[model samples]
Target: MSNLQNGFLLDDETELKTLLFEGEQDHLTPSTSRLLLESDFFVVAGRIIGHSFLNGGPCLVGLSQGIIHVLFGGEPETATVTESDCADQDVREVIRMLQGTKDLSEEEKSVVLSLTLPWDLPGVTVNNRHWLQEKILLHAVLERTAQQVKQIRRGLKDTGVWEFFSSRPDAVPVLFPRASEAEITPQMVIDNINWPKDEDIDEDILSLDDHCLIMSFLRRFIENGTSDILKSLLTFWTGWGVVCSNLEVEVIDCSLPQSSTCFLTLKLSKNHKNYEDFHQDLMASISSAYSGFGQI
Candidate 1:
C-alpha cells in the first residue's frame, strides 16, 4: 500500500502502481527500447502511435507520487510542432520526370505507377530482364518505412503513458485549429487547444513518454474532478523524453468563419529531469487551476 490521493480522496499508491506497471514484472521480452532510441524514424513512429491509442481511449489514469517526481523533474523546454507540407507540389510534374507519364494528379495512378506499374519507355521496358527486379526493390523500401512506422506507434501504446494522457484530455489542455485564411496559419496555442487533431502526434514527442505522471503526484489534491485529469496532463511531468527548451499555455480568440476552431500550443524543454521537480509543477498547476482559473 502506498500513500497517495486520486480524485477527491486517498488511494493506495502501490495498488495504482500495480494496476499500471505490474504487467511488466512477469518477464522482459525482446528489448526494443534500445532499438527505438537508435533512430529518429522509430522515435517519430512511436509518437504517432502513442497519440492514436491515447486519444482513442478514455481520458484518465491512476498515477503515483514517486513516478510523478521522476517524470516531470526538469526545466521546461520550448519546442513547436507543425504539419509537413506538400500541398502545392503538382503530382504531374513528378510523373513527367519519373516515367514521362502524361497524366498527373491521379493519386491512384501516381501511387501505382510510382511503385508497381512498370513502364516501357525508350530504354526501360517491363519486358526487360531486370525491370521487374527494380520494381520489387522500390516496393520493399516503401514497405519497410511503412512497417517501421506501425511498430513505433504500437510500442508507445504498450508503454501505458499513452493511456494515462488519453484518459484525461481536460487535464492536459487540448486545442484544434481550422483552415481559415488564404494562406495557412497555425490554429491554436496550447493554452487555447480544446480538441485533438485527426492526424497522430509526431513520434519524437511520444518518445519522451510523459503521461499519467501528473495524476500520480497530485493524487492528494485532485480528488475526482475534471481538474484532476487536467493536472495529470499539463503538470510538466509528462515531458521527460523530449528535449524541451520552453513551456507556455495561452488563450486567444480569432475572428473568421472557422473562428470556433481552437488550438493548443505547447513548448517543451529538451532535457530530462529527476522526478522530484516534476511533482512540484504538477501540484502547482493543479492548485493554480482553482486559485488562478482564468489567469491562464
Candidate 2:
C-alpha cells in the first residue's frame, strides 16, 4: 500500500514461476500427484491421496480431464489448461474414448509426447512420464488387493473355515478350525495300535482300527486345510516319490496377516500316567528342532 499509489500490486510472473518451480520437500510429506485425464468413469489409478512436500521437484503429472494441471512448487496452486484451449483439434479424442490414458491417445491425452532436445515438456511420453505414475498405479492396485483379502478374511470368519497346521510354535486359530481332532486316549492306542511280541514286519504289526483312525484324522486335515495345502497333502499322500534323506515338515499359513495361525494338537492323553514325561519330551523336541539341533 505504501510503495504503490494504486491498490493493485505489481504482477511478477518471473517470481511466481520461480516459486512454482521450486523443488519438493522429501521428509515432511508423502503425497503424490500425477495429473490424469478424466474418462467416463473415475479409474482408481488417476487420483492423488494425502499431501506431501515433494522434494522431488515439479514433475509434469500425467493426463487428467483431457487437460494439463501442473502442481506448483509445494504450493496449493496448480496451473491448468483445458482441451478446448489446446493447440490441436484432431487430438486423439476418439482413441481416448476407446482406451483410457493407460493406453496411448495424444489427441485425448493432455500431456504431449516427444523425444527431442529439451524433452521435459508437459505433454509428451504416452506411458512413461515420471516414475510417480507407476508408483501411483502400484499403490492403488496393492490397496485394492489388500481390501479384497480383508473381504475374504471376513467371509472365512463368518463361516468356520481356516488353517489346520500340524505343529506351530504359537498355534492359535485365525478362524474356528474345522473339527478334525479327537482325544487319543491311552486305551485306544493300546487296543488299536499295540502289536504282538517281536512283530517287526509292517504288514504283521498293522491294525485296521489304527489305520482307519489315521485316515480319518487326515481326512479332517484335508477338509479344513486350504486348497494349496490340500493339494500338497494329496500329492504327498499319493506317494509321488519316497526318498529318505532328511526329515522335513512344512506348516503352511492360509489366513490373513493380522489373524492367528491354524489350530493344531496331537499328543498323549492329558490324563495318562506318562503325560508329564511325554509333554517334556515333546517340548524339548520342538525347541530343539526349531533351534536346528534336532530332526523329525
Q: What is residue 276's positional error in candidate 1, in angstroms?
A: 39
State which candidate has the highest TM-score. 1
lDDT of 2 at 296: 31
What is candidate 2's local distance difference test score? 0.25
* Position 8, candidate 2: lDDT: 21
For each candidate, what TM-score against the reference?
0.22, 0.19
lDDT by residue (129-182, candidate 2, tens digit) is 444233222232222123322332333333322122113213322111112221
The list of candidate 2 runs beyond 4 A from truth reads: 1-203, 234-296
lDDT of 1 by residue, 1-296 (tens): 11111111214554332111111211101112333335443444345434533554222122212222112221112111011111112322332334543433457444545544433322334344244434333233222233343443354556555455445534332211111211111221122333222243343443313322322322332233243244334333222111112332221222100111122233222221434564444344434332242232
Q: Rate the local accuracy (lDDT) of all candidates.
A: 0.30, 0.25
